[model samples]
Target: MSKQVIALAYDGRNAPSVTAKGDDALAEAILAIAREHEVPIYENAELVRLLARLELGDAIPEALYRSIAEVIAFAWYLKGKAPVGFGQRDDGDAPLLLSGPER
Candidate 1:
């Protein structure tokens, strides 16, 4: 209910996992850690509310595939690639979460 923050982790093969989440002060800590780590931050209150219900390490719900896919793709585009070490292979041509390059 309080200002919430949810963090997800993804590899190019599997569904994204809910790696971290929190409310209120914990939410602030999550955001701070993300900033300190240079992690991409996505704001979608609707989606956050939905995802926040998920437990840590739980892959996103199938119903959220399309929405989450869009978010990942957008994040990839914004970053020019998935953030380093986010399951990015050494191959150097890895697309965002198994998705082909964004044209």
Candidate 2:
């Protein structure tokens, strides 16, 4: 069976960072790796909005750039086979119960 993938959104002051849904760290790492590889990145809605507020040819703020970088890194890590939940089946099956009982 295919695995369930989620879409992640980053809520920062400037750009609203969006990434492929996956483990937080993994996704960020993926984005970072992509950046390191010199891949072009696109801006999400939030980022566009923020950029729109600036004058043409204006430089982005440092804080906002840092936030964008972090979110991008996360997106990079998601490209690999990273598991979402703990103790769950890797094949996209439900987790097996080790112990269960009614209270």
Best by TM-score: 1
Segments in model 2 whose C-alpha atoms lie over 4 Å from true places = 1-43, 71-103
Identify the leading candidate in terms of lDDT.
1
Worst 10 residues of 2 by lDDT: 94-103
lDDT of 2 by residue, 17-49 (tens): 233332345445545664675444453545444
Reference-based lDDT, residue 2, model 2: 17
Model 1 C-alpha lDDT per residue in residues 1-103, reported as the tens digit of each score: 3577778877767888887777777778777787786666777777887886789879899999999888887867666665557675332322222111111
lDDT, residue 22, model 2: 28
- lDDT of candidates 1 onward, in order: 0.69, 0.37
TM-score of each: 0.76, 0.27
**Model 1 lDDT vs. the true structure?**
0.69
Per-residue error for 81 in candidate 2, Å, reads 22
TM-score of 2: 0.27
- After aligning candidate 1 to the native by TM-score, how far in Å is the CA of 51 from where it should be? 0.7
lDDT of 1 at 21: 79
